[model samples]
Target: MRITDLLKQDTAILDLQAQGKEAVIDELIAKLNEGGRLADSQAFREAIMLRESHSTTGLGDGVAIPRCS
Candidate 1:
């Protein structure tokens, strides 16, 4: 599925403060939870982590596409 499909308006952060990939992932999860997309913060965090493990979804040019099933 497209990343935009999974990206909630309230959860999609632009120019996040995190310094690394993991931190950026955590920030996304937090935003998703805050927006009530996931059941809880932990579940949201895990979902992003699992997706990243399979492949680097970064589409290059400083753009990253993250999706969860």
Candidate 2:
């Protein structure tokens, strides 16, 4: 599915205060719960974490693309 399709309204944090990977992950999880997309959220987060463990998804321009498996 498209990234936008998986992103729920609550998942869009226009102004996030947390800084760091862990905080970001927590925020994402919270958003997923708020959006009522637990299944999709868990799958997506897991994929991101796995990929991050192998290599950074950071594209070097301050952008990261986390996808769902």
Candidate 3:
């Protein structure tokens, strides 16, 4: 799906100040929660962590795809 379809001004944290991986995830989740994209942040966070445990999202292109199932 197009990111523009889901991403909006409210959900985009252009000035993220998170200092670490988990922290960044938390910050993004908070943004999504604030934007009404998630009904349960903790549960989603757990899922993302579970997925991360399988393998790193880093693609060696300075980008990471954080996903949860």
Candidate 4:
């Protein structure tokens, strides 16, 4: 299916009220969980946190692409 098809109204946070990196990640993960996107939210969170420990994912211009396995 197309990515647009997977997009949902409840999963979209128009106003991101997070300040820092971890907070943003937490907020996003919470949204994903609320929308029933993942099997284990805690595991996904730990994986992303571990990845962040290596280095920041900033690609410049106020952009960050955090990926998880």
Candidate 5:
């Protein structure tokens, strides 16, 4: 599947209220959970946080792509 395929109206946030990276991740996880995308939100959050602990996910210019499998 493509990124566009995964990013749907239900999962997309137009005006994000999250402040920092951690908050953003939490918000996104919640969004995915509400959209019925994530099977286990806590597990997914833990995996993402583990990946983040190894290194930064911030790309640059106030952008980040946090991911885990």
Candidate 6:
């Protein structure tokens, strides 16, 4: 599917209320879980946290692309 397809209203956060990195991850993970996109939220959270520990996904200009596997 295309990126637009994945960025539907169910999974998109128009006005993020999170204030920090971890908080942002948590919020997004919650959204994903709510959309039935994650089998285990805890596991996904751990993986994402581990990935962030290595280096930030921020690409500057207020953009970030966080991913985990």
Candidates in descending TM-score order: 5, 6, 3, 4, 1, 2
Candidate 4 wrongly placed segments (more than 4 Å): 1-9
Residue 19 local lDDT, model 3:
73
Give per-residue lDDT, candidate 3, residue 2.
58
Per-candidate TM-scores read 0.73, 0.69, 0.82, 0.77, 0.86, 0.85
Mark the 10 consecutive residues where model 4 has the least summed lDDT.
Answer: 1-10
RMSD of each: 2.4, 2.5, 2.0, 2.7, 1.6, 2.1
For model 5, the stretches where C-alpha displacement exceeds 4 angstroms are 1-5
Error of 2 at 5 (Å): 1.2
Q: Candidate 6, after superposition: displacement of residue 29 in Å?
A: 0.4
Q: Give the per-residue lDDT digits (tens) of candidate 4, residues 1-69.
A: 344633689888779899899999898889989998878999989998998898887898867766564
Q: Output the lDDT of residue 65, model 3.
A: 69
The CA-based lDDT of model 2 is what?
0.70
Q: Rate the local accuracy (lDDT) of all candidates.
A: 0.74, 0.70, 0.82, 0.81, 0.88, 0.85
Error of 3 at 7 (Å): 2.0
- The top-ranked prediction according to lDDT is 5
Superior by lDDT: candidate 1 or candidate 6: 6
| Ten contiguous residues minimizing lDDT sum, candidate 2 | 60-69
What is the alpha-carbon lDDT of model 4 when measured against the actual structure?
A: 0.81
lDDT tens per residue, model 3, 1-69: 455755788788778899778988899898889888887989989999999998878777556768865
Evaluation by TM-score, superior candidate among 3 and 4:
3
Model 5 clash pairs?
none
Clashing pairs in 1: none
The digit string of per-residue lDDT tens for model 6 on 1-67 reads: 3556457789999898997898998998899899988789999899989999999989998788777
